[model samples]
Every structure is written in C-alpha cells, then in structure tokens.
Target: MIAARSLFRAGAAGVMALCVALAVPAVAGAQPYPSKAIQIVTSVGPGSNFDQLGRVFAERLRQKLGVPVVLENATGGQGLVATRRVLNAKSDGYTLLLTSSGLATMPAIVKNAGYKAEDFVAVAPLGQVPFILYASSSVPATDIASFMSYLKSNAANLNMGLLTTSHITTMLARKFGKVVGGELVEIGYRSSPETLSALLANDIQMVATTHAIAGQHVALGKIKAIGVVADERTQAVPDLPTFKEMGYPTLVINVWEALFAKADVPKDVLDKIRAVSREIVSDPSYLTAMVPTGMEPWRIPFDSLQSVIDEEAKAFKKDADELKISFD
Candidate 1:
C-alpha cells in the first residue's frame, strides 16, 4: 500500500512537471499575442483602394495572430474619422489604423484632426498606385503638353473633377494651376462612380483619379490618359510618362497605404507584428488576393519601441501654410 501511494504521488508530480513545461511556450505565445479579435479601422469605403488594403492586412494578420479581425470604417474627413477611432481606442495591439498620404495632409484640411502622423506607427507598406491624368476623349487635348495648353487657354471653360475638396487632388490641381498660370473649375465629387459618370456625360472636361477608376474607361476608349502623376511609370501603363518627365516634378506623387497600431505596444509584440506583417504582405497568396482588386502589397515595417506617436506629435507641421481650413 505504501509503495502504491508513493508511485501515485510520483506520477502526479511528473504530470504536473509536464504541464508546466508545456505551459512555458503556451504562455510565451500568449504574451506576444492578441488573445481577442483585432480591429482595423479605415476611412475609405468598401470598394475603395484603401479599404481593400486595410481588409487584406486584417485578413493576413488574423491568420498570423490566430484571432479574427474586424474592419471598422468611419468614411470621411479625408480618413480622419476612421483613423481617430483607432487612435482613441485602447493602444493595445488589437486595434490598428490604416491610412494613406492624407495622414500628411489632414491637419491642413481640418481643425483638431484629433491625431497626426506621429500618432501611429508603420507596420507595413501596403502598396503604391499612380494617379492617372484621365480626360474624356470627347475633349480635344490628346497629350500632356496639349492638355496643359488647353487648360491655360480655356481656364474658365474647362472643369476638373476628383475625389474631394480637401483631398490631395485639390492641392495637385492648385499646383497645376499655379504652374500653368490658370484657374481650374474644380468639381469635388465624393466618389469615383459619380466622378466618372459626370465625365462620361461630359459634365466635367478632365479628371485626376486612379487607374483603377479610369482604367476601364481608358480601355474602352471612353477616356484618354494623357499623363501619369507618379515619379515613375506603372507596369499597367508603361508608355505613359509621368508629369515630372513631362516637366512637372512635385506633381509626381504615388498614393500609398501603411498599417499602424497604437504608439505604446511592447517591443516584443511589435517585433512579432512586424514579422507577421512582412510575411503577410509579401506572401504570394496575399498579393494574389490584392492584385486582382487593384491593391499592391508592399511591406514597410516599424518596431514597437519606435515613434508612431512621434509622427503624430507634429500634426500641425505638415499642414500647408496656405491652407485656410475652418471647422466652424
């Protein structure tokens, strides 16, 4: 009886030791984790490029983190409404904000944009897309030089259309107008659909929008791409030279998307997230899913200890000096 009791005690001890041994990795994994669902907040709508990139990141992160991801959209204020939601959420890894160049331009457009570029850190660079200079074939300008000339000659007569009043389009249009010494009749539409419909109906003479929005139209010969707004040409439209190559340099800006979480996540957690981000963004499966939808995956990683909040710190610094945006 004594021997049996001793054996039973030994077996129990061994089992407890095994459990403890197994628990170390389990606990470690849990430590680096989000044990709950993750939230990805974006301002772009369901079919927009930014929204698509945000969803792709969420899906990939969900797979790597072993948790479901929920994408919440706030859809306006040039992406601030959605981004602010993430910034205000608890700084835990569970919530991430997806953003584009508007992070650099929002402070100029709205008062109390609530957060700045320093507010969040970059997890990955989703991809880059070139803005196309598209115009209805119904208009007479067939090329970049001619387009500028026509705009200059018919400044009061020509109308330009894009996504929003406070968007990069406005700034670009202003720059273009300044370069050519002319004023554009700017039509600020909320979405590409309305913008395209108006252009198709000859309601607008020109549009500076995405190839995704304009590609189908361009292919159908409904519109012509006179120039690209990127520094380099795109694979889809290699023959189209950038505005810089045609003499306008600063106009060459590629739209980009980046992943960001709160500024105060743990170092290890950030490293893990970065690792997963690199894997996810570079994974061919992710690219396959994104490319068909017009999103190109590019990974630009950041360490957790790094300064996402530092980027937010100077919210006012990136504001354009000429911008006179008023909340009231």
Candidate 2:
C-alpha cells in the first residue's frame, strides 16, 4: 500500500512538471506578434485612387508580413470617419489609417471632426499629387492667360465644380477668381467623378482636380489642362505649366496621403511598421502602381514624420485662417 501511494504521488508530480514546461513559453515569450490579420482603414470610397493606394499597400503587406491585410473603407466626413475608427482601435500595429492630404486640412475645415493633426502619427508618406485645372474643350480658353481673360469677362456668370466649399480645391477655385478679376461661382459635388461628369456634360465650365482622374480625359481631348497647382511641373505632364509660371505663384495645391497610427503605439511596433513602410514605398511594384497615376514616392522616415506633420498642420491652419474659411 505504501509503495502504491508513493508511486501515485510521483506520477502526479511528473504530470504537473510537464504541464508547466508546456505553458512557460506561451506566458513568457509569446508568439511573434501580428501572428494574425491586419487591417488598413481608408477615407475614400471604393474605385477611387485613394482606395487603389490602400489595396496596393495591403497587397504588399500580405507578401511582406506573411498575413492577410484587409482594407476597410469608412468614407464620410471627408476623413473623420476613418480617422476616428483607427484612433479608437487598439494601439497594436494591427490597425492603420491610410488617408489623403485632406488629413492635413480636414480638421480645420470640417466642424466637429473631434480630432487634431497631432492625434495621429504619420508612419508612411506617399508622394504629392498636383491638382490640374481642367477646362472643357468647348470652352474658348486655350491657355492660362486666355482662361483668366474668360473668367474676367464672365465674372460671376462662370460656374466651377468643387467637392465642397471648404475643400482646398474650392479654395483654389476661389483664389483663381481673386487672382483674375471674376467671381467664378462655386458649385459643390459629392465625389470627384461627379465633378468630372459635370465638366464633361458642360454642366460646369471648369474643375480643379487631380491628374489621375483628369489624365484620361485630357488624352481623349475632351478637356484641356491649363494650370498645375504644384511647385514644379510633374513628370506625368511635363508640358503642363505650374501655377507660378501662369502668374499665380502661391496657387500651389498638391495633395498627398500617408499611413498613420495612434500616437501611443509602442516604439518597437512602430519601428517594425516603419521598416515595412520603407520597403513598401521603395518596392518596384509600388512605383509601378504610382506611375499610372502621376504619383511619385514621398517616403518620410519614422523619426522625422512628426515634425513634418506639425509643419504641414501649421501651414494649413495659416492658410485656412487667411481665407476666413470654416466648414461649419
């Protein structure tokens, strides 16, 4: 009886030791993180160039991270919907925000956005996209000077299509009127496609938009690109003159998107993500994806991103204040 009892106790002790050995690695070391899926939230609707950027990033992440990276479109409020969603998510590297240049100006322009530029940290910056001022082929204007003359002659009679009254494009359109001697009545639309359609149908005379949406239209000879709102003419449209050359030097209105995470994300995690971003932006595949849309690489390292963001915010706020613009 004594021998049997001793044997049973020893067996139980062995079992406990085995169980502890099995559990220690899980509790102490844990699995290499991101062992699961990741998600990228974007502010644009599906089929837009912004959506395409998200898809491209997700695809590259899947290949690099060896896990599925999904894209969630939370389109509304210019970008607050998507921004808030990511802000409220776990600071774990699993959730990310892929947004446009609007991220820089939206809060100042959109009332009750409930967030500031400092709330999110920039992780990756995709290059700047210069806005092209396109005029309908039916319009008599052939060059920037001629276009200004037309605006002066028409004054308040000329209609311009814009996404919103507070949008940078709208501001540029208004500034165009101010630069020349016309009113250039603003007409709002819900999407870039609608604005393009309005311009195509001659419902609106001119539209200030990105090259991606207007490039094909220009190719088809349906519209003419008269002014480029960029510091320099883009390679995609080298022949197009910058607004400065056209005598509107400060009319620069380049738009760009960047990947962002919550400010509290762990340094190690953010480093991992930034490293991944460096790879993604430099990948030949990414460059190919951008080439079609006239987008060039604009990657900022993790450490310098905040300073850049701050500077951009300041510039945007100054511009907004000068314009006396408030979306509300």
The numbered model that scores best in TM-score is 2
Choose the strongest candidate by lDDT: 2
TM-scores of the models, in the given order?
Answer: 0.81, 0.85
Give the local distance difference test score of model 2.
Answer: 0.80
> What would the per-residue lDDT of candidate 2 be over residues 161-185, giving only the tens digit for each residue?
9896227777777677767756678
lDDT minimum window of 10 residues, candidate 2 = 293-302
The RMSD of every model to the true structure, in order and in angstroms, is 6.9, 5.0
lDDT of 2 at 211: 81
**lDDT of model 2 at position 91:** 89
Error of 2 at 223 (Å): 2.1
**Which parts of model 2 have CA positions greater than 4 angstroms off?**
1-29, 299-304
lDDT of 1 at 147: 84
Which segments of candidate 1 are over 4 A away from where they belong? 1-30, 297-319, 322-328
